[model samples]
Target: MTTNNGRAFTAPQLEGAVWKKSSYSGDSQGQCVEVAALTFAPFAGMRAIRDSKNPDGPALVFPESSITGFLADLADGKFGN
Candidate 1:
């Protein structure tokens, strides 16, 4: 399925999966998101993040390479806050 951002990744049935709020999330209108990895489904890749409030909504899945680049830029403070 596709998310609002056009991300076509499978959304896991996280009825019992553990979810974690981002460290960046704060008391700013609850924009916090959560993520959890699956065990049996391997095609979903290594990482998955989704809106914490909407458990059945869309999720954005990124490839390892793309995530690396994004994290590198983030570490360098390349993105504007």
Candidate 2:
């Protein structure tokens, strides 16, 4: 996979991946995000995020630490409304 802006990436293939959306993803239907864990070699322990509206589109891969920090910050309200 190729990295983009240190947070997003483009994988050549992602077969067998099981994508899941957040529980907070309401019934907006067309607007939501999905995440999948890459447990294969070279990408093991990494997390992949994408727009649920486009499952076949590219995904943004991030290290597990990055995902943790992002969620922590979100919970702490670091990103003001």
Candidate 3:
């Protein structure tokens, strides 16, 4: 069976995760995002992303490798602005 690691997790499911936002989000009105590192079972080494404005909302979880690669691509401007 193929395991799906990327999934949208509920607030309660991520209660143990520590969320953090970007430093460049200052003065941005409702345009900030937060990321948390998951350390529990079935979520270890995973990353969770969510809107900073909605702390109680669902969060998208991804593997550490995926998040790292995505950040690298982002830094390389893979997704043109």
lDDT tens per residue, model 2, 23-43: 888887868899888887666
- Candidate 3: give the clashing pairs: none
Model 1 lDDT per residue over 1-81, tens place: 332232545354434455677788875658778766533344244445788777678666555556668789999999878
Off by over 4 Å in 1: 1-6, 9-17, 26-29
TM accuracy, model 3:
0.86
lDDT at residue 36 of model 2 (Cα atoms): 89
Question: What is the Cα root-mean-square deviation between model 2 and the actual structure?
Answer: 2.3
Alpha carbon lDDT of residue 24, candidate 1? 89
Stretches of candidate 2 exceeding 4 Å from the true structure:
1-12
Best by TM-score: 3
| Number of the candidate with higher TM-score, 2 or 3 | 3
- CA displacement after TM-score superposition, residue 52 of candidate 1 (Å): 0.9
* Candidates ranked, most accurate by TM-score first: 3, 2, 1
* C-alpha lDDT values of all predictions: 0.60, 0.78, 0.85
Cα lDDT tens digits, model 3, 13-78, are 788899899998986765899999889887887889999999899898888999999999999999
